[model samples]
Target: MTAYAVAHLRPAARLDDEVFEYMERIQSTFAPYGGAFLVHGTTPEVLEGQWPGGLVVIGFPTLHDARDWYESKAYQEIAPLRTRHLAGDVILVDGVAPGYDASLTAARMREAQEA
Candidate 1:
C-alpha cells in the first residue's frame, strides 16, 4: 500500500546554520528508501478552519519505506531541527491498495435473492 507523511507545521524560529546544512544533506536519504516529496513548503488554499502554517506531504512506495525513512539514523539526527523550527502535527497514513473489494457484497446480495 502507498503511504504518506503529512506534516502540518506552525513555523517558529529559523533553523541554525548547522541544522540547515544537515537539512540540505538529507536529500540523499529519500532515494534509497523510495521516498520523495510530493509537496514541500507549498502554501495551501485554506477553505476550512484555522490554517496551520507550513505543510509538507512526502510520498513513499509503502508504509515500510516511510517508516524506514523516519526511523533511520540519518533523519533522526536532524529531526530535532525540524521540531525546533516548526511546531504542529506530523503523521503517517496508509492508503488503500488496488482492487480491494474483498467483501464482494454485490455477489452476496444476488445469491441471497436467488435463494
Candidate 2:
C-alpha cells in the first residue's frame, strides 16, 4: 500500500538560507526510498478552518519505505536544516486498500458499541 509523509510546517520567523539549502538537498534524500512529492509549498485556498504555513506531502511505495526514508542517515544529517527553522508536525500514514468500504468499519464500530 502507498503511504504518505505529511507535514504542516510554519516558519519560526522567516525562511532563511538554511531552509533553502535543505530544500535543495531534500530531493536527493528521497531517491533511494521511492519517495516523491505529491505537494510542496503551495498556498492552499482555505474554505473552512484556519491553516497557517506551508504543507508538504510526499508519497512512498509503502509505510516501510516512508519510515526508512525518514530514518536514513543522509536525511538525518540534513534534517536539522529544516527542523531548526520550522515548526510543524509530521506523520506517516498507510493508504487504504483497493475496494475498501467505510460500511465495514461502521459495522465493526456498531458491533463494538453494542458490546
Candidate 3:
C-alpha cells in the first residue's frame, strides 16, 4: 500500500532566517528515505474553510517507509525548525492500490490480525 504524509501548516507570526534555513535542510532529507513530494507549494484556491497557510503531501511506498523517514535521525535534526515556525496537522494514510476492493482490503486486514 502507498502511504502519504499530509500536513497542513500555518506560517509563524513572521518568517525569519531560521524558517528558511529549516526549509533548506528539511527538504534535503526526504529523498534518502524514499520520500517524494506530491504537493509542496501554496494552495491557490480555497475550497472550504479559511486555512491561512500551506499544505504539503509526501508520498512513500509503504506506511513503514513513511514512518522510517519521519523518525529518522536526519529528519529529527531539523524537525524543530518547522514546528517552531509553523503549526499543522500531520497524518499518514494508506492508499488503495489499483484494482482495490473493499472486501479484499478487509480480508487482508483480517489475515494480518489473525497472524
Candidate 4:
C-alpha cells in the first residue's frame, strides 16, 4: 500500500532559512524514493493542537519507500534542522489501500463535479 508521512513543524524562532534549506534537501532526497509532496505548509482550519506550526505531507510509492527515505543517511544529516526548528510532532501513516481505482475515483469526482 502507498504510504504518507505527515510532518508538523513548529519552527524555532528565526529559523525560516534553515527550515527552507532542510525542505529543499528533503525534496531532493525524495526523488530517489518515489516520493512526492502532497501538501507543504498548509494551515488547518481548526487549530486544536497544542503545537502550532507548519504542516508537510509527503506521499510515497510504498510504506517501505517512505521508511527508507525517513531513515536514509541523507535525510539524517539534515534532520537536526527539522528538530531544532520545530517543537512539534511528526507522523507517518500508511494509506488505506494499494493502487487506487482511478476510474472509480474519477467517476466519483465527476459525480461530485456535476452535483
lDDT by residue (tens digit), candidate 2, 20-101: 9999999899889999999997987889999898889999999999999999999999999989889999999999999989
Q: Rate the local accuracy (lDDT) of all candidates.
A: 0.80, 0.92, 0.85, 0.82
Which pairs of residues collide in model 3?
A: none
- Find the candidate with the highest TM-score and give its number: 2
Where does candidate 2 stray beyond 4 Å?
Answer: none
Window of ten residues with lowest summed lDDT in model 2? 8-17
Pick by TM-score: 2 or 4, better one: 2
* Weakest ten-residue segment in model 1 by summed lDDT: 14-23
TM-score for each candidate, following the candidate numbering: 0.75, 0.93, 0.79, 0.74
Clashes of each: 0, 0, 0, 2
Residue pairs with backbone overlap in model 2:
none
lDDT of 4 by residue, 1-115 (tens): 8899888767666776777788778898878999999988677565574547677899998889999998999888998877776687777788866566889989999999999
Q: Give the best candidate by lDDT.
A: 2
Better of 2 and 4 by lDDT: 2
Q: Which residue pairs of candidate 4 clash? A: 10-86, 12-85
The TM-score, computed over Cα atoms with residue i paired to residue i, of candidate 4 is: 0.74
